[model samples]
Target: MNSRAPLNTAPPGMAEGLPVRFADVSWDSMRHDIEYVLVAPQRTRQPLLVFLHEGLGSVTMWKDFPYALCEAAGCRGLVLSRWGYGQSSPRPGHEKWPVDFMHRQARDFLPAFFEAIGHDTRADPPWLYGHSDGGSIALLHAAACPGRVGGLIVAAPHLFVEPVTLASIQQARDGYVTTDLRSKLARYHADPDSAFWGWNDVWLNPEFKHWNIQALLSAIRCPVLAVQGHDDEYGSMAQIDGIAQEVPQAELLKLDDCGHSPHRDQPARLIEASVAFMRRHRT
Candidate 1:
């Protein structure tokens, strides 16, 4: 375990007045350090809520949402920039991610990350809150290790690849080149190209079209709250609808006039719903 250090006291960010501590998690398979930060670390007795960012999202990209939600729910928060995103180690230039990248994250990286962070899921399983790609990851984790999850809250998660999602990713690729997407992403990621292309290329890969995790949803035994924007551009209602279908007890919330990101598009509503869900499922 790497020594914890106080993060720079930057105003109006995720940590804020809390003790924002960084951990260097050794990802044995990938041989890299995964950067993670804990909010309200002193409140260890409170339920743990792990926040997962989107494909283009990093610790910084999430801004104050994690902190806000954590406060409302009165829980500890764990926000981490996945490998190849944010200040964490970038993807190796020679390596290419497979279609099962999200699966790998859920089954492999998350467990290692939890161990490195000294979180014993078996003794105290944490609730998972994820957005977009992160949402999908949260579901995968819950499915794979239901015993280690207290509950699940996902926003705009993808259970399967959709034509609309492919189109949006393609548009993003064009925007990355034709517009200032790269520059904007640079504010959050150390190597924006690694983050961009790693996500973009895999989604656009023809073989990836068949990627799906619908079958795995049945394994998730914990309580679930799946939310999506009514106007989500990346995916259709079928995403959350599919969750409801598989996880029959899964709660669904469709926000009006919202987009792919419920945390950004309708945070207050999301937070309220999330707090209620966590409280209801609190063991």
Candidate 2:
């Protein structure tokens, strides 16, 4: 985050959350433990919003937006760091994320995390607000869980990896390996490589070029709002365009002068659009 950027509207809530361990899956002979932030609003059973962070993001990286958004929407929230992020355990240095990383995040890991957090997704699937890679995961999950999810808000999601994406990711890798990017990432993640390669290598690898989730978007049955900025460096309008095309009921919001992070770029507009979308989708 730039030092000159405006501070988050609300201060980050306390980060003293307890650790949650998920069973039924193993990574490196270890059952992963997830660190999460749960915020329940006053009185209503207002929808539960689960925030999925970016490829290199952790719970703390979200700053205060989750809290602010939850307050604005009068909803509860669950913000969790996937394994190998934030306070979660680190992935083995030699390991590489599979081509199915996003799918596992959506179909396998997410359900376990929510279950561990006491959220019975079978009864009430969450309203997912995902950024970047997280946005992609949200789309997959909503599609896989069709009738379960209340709604989905995907900010800068990718249905397919474009050349532009690989270029940007390659640049990021160079910055991390040769520049001070590691120190910078230290502010957000416990192990910067866990943050960096976990995203970079997979996105830039040759085999990942064929990775596409357009079919998953077509499977989504609930309301979905796909927002992106005109100036996003990682992807273009085609992302949201594909979503609208694949999911006929999907809504689109394109912003000017904004980049990859819509919530950070235009907080007020993001909030207004979100509130309206939620209301439109609520049962």
Candidate 3:
């Protein structure tokens, strides 16, 4: 991780804007136009922090949290919208994402995405900060890729499907159809159906009920910080506790009075812990 290439240096006076851009990448046997932005690229020598969004999230949905974290941690941040989210390419028709969709993104799509966007996975590995589904993807990436990424911090991640998660997702499915959820999602995704239905259909599928990664966590060889809110609707404390059991170097942060989104419900605390964690493993 010693190489300091200005692969994505921000344009002059563009730090405040965090403008969205696109990159054509070949991943999972297909070409995808990824939506992304670089935060504080002026700090070329600093470590790279990559933000992986949630199931229904996009680059815009992240708002200014990446900027705040990068500023506090003294690192550069790379935020991207995975295929089917934001202004990136939409999911093909109404097909559902495979049960191993996260696997594909972590083991295949992510590396290719980084390469297409000029982030050298070997020369300058990134520290992943993932939330919800993004968090699960982070765990899969860290486990499968081993040393490709520097380290990771996952918030409200699910290593397996839980009853509560499925119920909530079912509720979300109903909301998407009955309420204004689609209208709200339209603000962030180019095709809200691509993000919502793809994620929903897979999670609600019968085959996904037993999708578990507990066995793979041991393969992760990098520092890991697993954060979860006490009241997280998507998962219980067992998620992070399960991670700690497998990865000896893993640390856990359980926040009180918070929900599924720690960055939103507890930004100050999350940022402080994140800054400290990055500093401790700055090597």
Report lDDT (CA) for all predictions: 0.88, 0.80, 0.88
For each candidate in turn, the TM-score is 0.96, 0.90, 0.94
TM-score (C-alpha, index-matched) for candidate 3: 0.94
Question: Which residue pairs in candidate 1 have backbone atoms (N, alpha carbon, C) closer than 3 angstroms, thus clashing?
Answer: none
- In candidate 2, how many Å is residue 125 off? 2.1
Decide which is better by lDDT, 2 or 3: 3
Give the CA lDDT, 0 to 100, for residue 116 in model 3.
80
Candidate 3, overall lDDT? 0.88
Ranking by TM-score: 1, 3, 2
lDDT of 2: 0.80
Instruction: For each of the candidates, give the backbone clash count.
Output: 0, 0, 0
* Residue-by-residue lDDT tens digits, candidate 2, 119-211: 677687679999999999999999888776889999999999888988889898889989999998887677888878888878877999999
Model 3: per-residue Cα lDDT over 36-150, one tens digit each: 8888889888899999999998888887788899999999998888999987889997477998899888888888888787777778878999999999899999888876888
* Cα error, candidate 3, residue 179 (Å): 0.5
Most TM-score-accurate candidate:
1
Model 2: lDDT of residue 187: 77
